[model samples]
Target: MTNERRVLVHPDADALVAAVSARFLTKLTDLLDEHHEANVVLTGGTLGEAVQKAVATSPMRSAIDWTRVHFWWGDERFVPKDDPDRNEVQAREALLQHLPTAEDHIHPFPASDEIEDIDAAAEAYAQELRDHADPALRLPVPRFDITFLGVGPDGHIASLFPEHGVTRDGQDLVVSDEDSPKPPPRRLSLTLPVINSSQRIWMVLAGTEKASALGLALAGASPEEVPVAGAEGRLRTVFFIDGDAASHVPADLIASQY
Candidate 1:
């Protein structure tokens, strides 16, 4: 991982989305150039959806082969697949519906109805990763080329909320979080260990309310207190902040060399 935190500040949310979209496309193109496929972990939120929309509408959208790109979500609401609140549903409407990607490439968490047992559903997703990865791999998890994440006002990422047991649990790549501050109460989230396994991770923030949380995360707060602070990718980790969300970060802090 790099020593410096890569923070990109934009004039507004629209500009932020454009910058993030370009970065996302560059990362995807790099992954495809090095490997035959690209695996991306998506998130659910306004900023996240904006990035997806950017990708869908970008002029370079056609440069990559959508068919070979694999999509996964960082977390999901434990709702029926067709529920309007489901992240998958929102993502499809925002971007996937526009992409030429194959159905098999889109892997969403199991719907509550699909698997009666939430724990079993999480385990099933873990097994799916194992099946796709080589046995000799130490991590035993798929190396995501890019993981797009959104931070909650409480400084949570994915479904890993502050002081939640799932935030510290190290075994499962996917786990059911039962005490999320935000509801539906129950959710499936990628553990911090799994999130750190990605080659690149990007945390996107847009609203003014997120400014305080962004400052705390940048200050290196503990994940137990602010879960977003724990994100660390092997190759790179970036924070894409709009002016509104970066207002609380001190000018000197941002000017410091790492």
Candidate 2:
């Protein structure tokens, strides 16, 4: 069974950050208590980095067993590993640097500079996931415990842009995107099939410029029109939005309760 999409609106960016941080800690604690290991797929963007900062600043940060948490990227900028624009670099500055996780547990996509071939690098990442699968389990693929994603003002998520082939296919995972609307133009994104396999998924939006896209997604736009509409999770799917971002969503409906 799949969970219905739900939204949580906050008064401002600060409040949104707090809500995301609190929920993140709660989810991490609950997952840790219920299972010995947890897999987290993280997104990259201003809001995504803010959530990381909030986690780092939260008092309950220490409660998580970082060693048992496997971190993965939802999508990354096709740049050099050390580039300031790289998602991994920003993520490290915000939270990963403060966490006690072993360096090996942090899984970042290959750098465009080092790999030379973007498609090959993406294929390697897919292979890594396959290699990590539990031998005893006959599941089609390894599933993540949680996946944190952020939507673009254009409504794309995890590099799955509107009308893109990757957004329409039901592949387990994708190794390359040929026509990304976003800059850098190329990326590897988890397909809808893989994204929906997660136990939980959270979509966070913060800027006022994102309001229109948020409204469309909550109103059930087609994935080809707004890729964010494709977001789904087997257990839960949540939308975390600040006031500026939620302003366009109908007041009588979703955001009012929050």
Candidate 3:
């Protein structure tokens, strides 16, 4: 793990989405070139959905074989599969449905109706990851080429909220949350350890509400106090933020274009 961190600030939310979408396409293309297939973990939020929409509308959308690209979500609301609030549902409506990806390649967490117990659903997803992992990859989770995340206003990543017991929990690759701080308390999420295993991580931020959290995490705040501080890619960690979100970050830490 190189553990390199880069902070990129865009002019605004729209430019941020465009830049991220372009990079997403290029990253997938590069990974597919080196391997038979590529794996990417998706996030859910306003910026996340915007990025997906950008991808769907990008001219380079067809550059890679969508069938060989496996999609997984970092976390999902424990709602019915068809619920508009479900991350999987939002992703499909935003982009996945337009792609040629096979049903088998889209790994969405089980919904409430699919499994009676949230813990059971989380375990099942972990098993699914183990089954898909190639022995040569030697990872608890699949060797993700890129993992996407959205930092919450409170500095949480995925469903691992700051100071939550789950943030320090290392036992499960996927954890179940029945009491999330946000509404729709139920959720299933890949733990910080599991997310950090990815080769590359992209944390996308858009609005000013996230600026304080982003600033704190990038400045060496304790992960236990700010869960977003805990997640870093094995090779490369990137913060793709719009100016509003990057406003609170130190001028020196920002890569360029203030």
Candidate 4:
């Protein structure tokens, strides 16, 4: 774990998406060159869709054997599988559906109807993560090659809202938020510890609304107060932000070269 952090600023959201999508494919290609399999965690939102759509359309999408790459989500809404609000649904429509990935390789958290409750859904996903972990290492969760995330205007990452108990919780690999600050309250999310376990954490931010949140995260605010601040990847932490979102970023914190 190098624990290196980088801030990449793009001129606009479109550019940010393009850059990220290309890097996503290129990095996956590099990882596949070194390993037989790789694990990638996805995110949900307009930004997520943009990135997925970019990757889906790019010719570079074929750079790696999609079947060998396992897809997981950092967080998911506690809704039915087909619900428009579900992260898995959006991801499938924008990208996964187009890829030749194996059915078992795409891991989506249990839907509301598929499970009795959010707690059960969290446990189910936790078990799923454990199932894919290296038995010899005895890990509770598999090592994520890359985990993509989005930060809320309020500085929340995934469903771990600011000041929420889930943000402060460290015991669980996966946690539920029944009272999220944002609408559509119910959600299941990987905890900060689990997120930090990833080899690379790519945080995509867009719009002026994210300016303050990015500042607080870069300022090192407490995770309970700004959960986005807690997302430090084992090897690298990257903030792929548009100029609007980068407005509040300190000059020194910005990485001159990626």
- For all predicted structures, in order, the TM-scores are 0.93, 0.91, 0.96, 0.96
Which parts of model 3 are misplaced by more than 4 Å? 136-138
Q: Please, what are the lDDT tens digits per residue for candidate 3 over residues 212-253?
A: 999889888888888888888988899999888987888888
Q: Which ten residues in a row have the lowest lDDT in candidate 2?
A: 134-143
Write down the worst ten-residue block by lDDT for model 3.
163-172
Instruction: List residue ranges in candidate 4 displaced over 4 A.
Output: 135-139, 167-169
Residue 180's C-alpha lDDT in candidate 2?
Answer: 70
TM-score of 1: 0.93
Better of 2 and 4 by TM-score: 4
**lDDT for position 149 in model 1:** 95
C-alpha positional error of residue 130 in candidate 3 after TM-score superposition, expressed in Å: 0.6
Which residue pairs clash within candidate 2?
none
Q: Tell me the tens digit of each residue's lDDT in model 4 across 1-258.
A: 369999999999899999999999999999999989999999999999999999999999977799999999999899887899999999999999999999999999999989967898899999999989854332478879999999999888888888787454456888888888887999898988888878899999999999999999889889888889889888899999999998899999898768
Better of 2 and 4 by lDDT: 4
For all predictions, the C-alpha RMSD in Å is 2.2, 2.3, 1.6, 1.4
What is each predicted model's overall lDDT from 0 to 1? Answer: 0.84, 0.81, 0.89, 0.90
Model 1 Cα lDDT, one tens digit per residue, 54-160? 98999989888888899998988888889887899989999999999999888899888898788998988888777666343356777687889999898989998
Judged by lDDT against the true structure, how good is candidate 1?
0.84
Steric clash pairs (candidate 1): none
How many clashes show up in model 2? Answer: 0
Ranking by TM-score: 4, 3, 1, 2
